[model samples]
Target: MRLKVDFHDQTETLTPEQIVLIENLLNKAAEIEGIEEGSEVSVSFVNNDEIQEINREYRNIDKPTDVISFALNEQDEDELAVIGEGIPNLLGDIIISIPKTIEQADSYGHSFERELGFLAVHGILHLLGYDHMTEEDEKIMFSRQEEILAAYGLKR
Candidate 1:
């Protein structure tokens, strides 16, 4: 698939290798989700303060989150129509808190790369209409996340 990833590193937390790893993981995620070719996804790395502001503004949660997704296609009929017309599918934006990622990695006893990949996959799944709001949905979404991570060699 023609997956176009636009990466914005507001925080210089990722090395070149880690950046490449994230892109590869996201591409694999799109493939697994059966996303159409020529789709586009945006990934942004930000600090805790920036993410906390975004979290509060968008989700009204007054706290920093590890990741946040803004799905462009969800509930947007015009966007869906463009996607159906062979245009590049604008999947959505995935904003990640680099500091939060590091904290979670240490707390969870995993590599930063693994945690980053997990968050990226999680955000992408959300862009693809996956949610963990209910128990059954949580089971399905978490299982898929693990499977995708393992396949991409980012196992926990």
Candidate 2:
């Protein structure tokens, strides 16, 4: 399935190659998850300050986070579908902190691209309804993340 990933770089620091990597990584992840073709997801890059403000406002947290995801299609199993035929599913928005990506990459002793790839996949999985509130859930979600990232050649 072809997933359309729209990116808005608030930090404007991503190289063309980084953008392409994110797009390709997300598409690969979608394909692995069996997401339908034409589904749309948006990813935005911001600085620590902006991400902190967003985290404060949305999540009641005052600190900056590495990434944040806003899922658009979250629904219960019995919820009725409102989307029409041929309409691409509006998956969600993912916001990443450029500074955080750099910091985390350095802290983890990995490449910047690897950290970015990990954040993008983590956000997309959140949009896909994967959560890590519990140990078991974290294991499930994180393993899936590792599987996708390894398949995309981003390992650490």
Candidate 3:
């Protein structure tokens, strides 16, 4: 249940509770997936401008996204394994766009907290290698997200 979180944006202000919420949600995901308890994960907050740059750089898309996850689990395990003493599993990174999250929350008729929870869970799933490039994939991904969010009482 050890996670290292880092924020990379200026405008995405979050309270300590919100930070802890993300950490809890990450641990919930790991627990449901039966991953190790001492897992390592990082969540980063970003503004639209910063996310736009990352989207273009990594995804070749020129638009800002609500959230994006870069997974370390899909790569070579030996290469990614930490050498430190009792180091947790390095899951990877979740980058969230602040302004975009606000707008999407408004657009989707949900509270800021609910939207935040959804995006955080979504990002974790991606880090766990879930994608929605197809219809069935979309169904499974969204269902799992809804299930987790509901369990956390974040469902609408």
Whose TM-score is greatest here? Answer: 2
Ranking by TM-score: 2, 1, 3
lDDT of 3 at 15: 79
Error of 3 at 61 (Å): 0.5
Worst 10 residues of 3 by lDDT: 1-10
lDDT of 3 by residue, 1-156 (tens): 544555454664987788778777766777777777677777888888888999999999998989989997676756654467776668888988878878988999988888888999999899888899999999999999998887777776
- Scanning candidate 2 in windows of ten residues, the lowest lDDT window is 79-88
Write down the worst ten-residue block by lDDT for model 1.
Answer: 76-85
TM-score of each: 0.93, 0.95, 0.88
C-alpha RMSD of candidate 2: 1.6
Q: What shift in Å separates residue 34 of candidate 2 from its native position after superposition?
A: 0.5
Residue ranges of candidate 2 with Cα displaced over 4 Å: 76-80
Residue 95, candidate 1: Cα error in Å is 0.3
Residue 101 deviation, candidate 3, in Å? 0.8
Clashes of 3: 1
Model 1 gets an lDDT of: 0.91
10-113 per-residue lDDT for model 2 (tens digits): 88899999999999999999999999999999999999999999999999999999999999888789998778888789999999999999999999999999
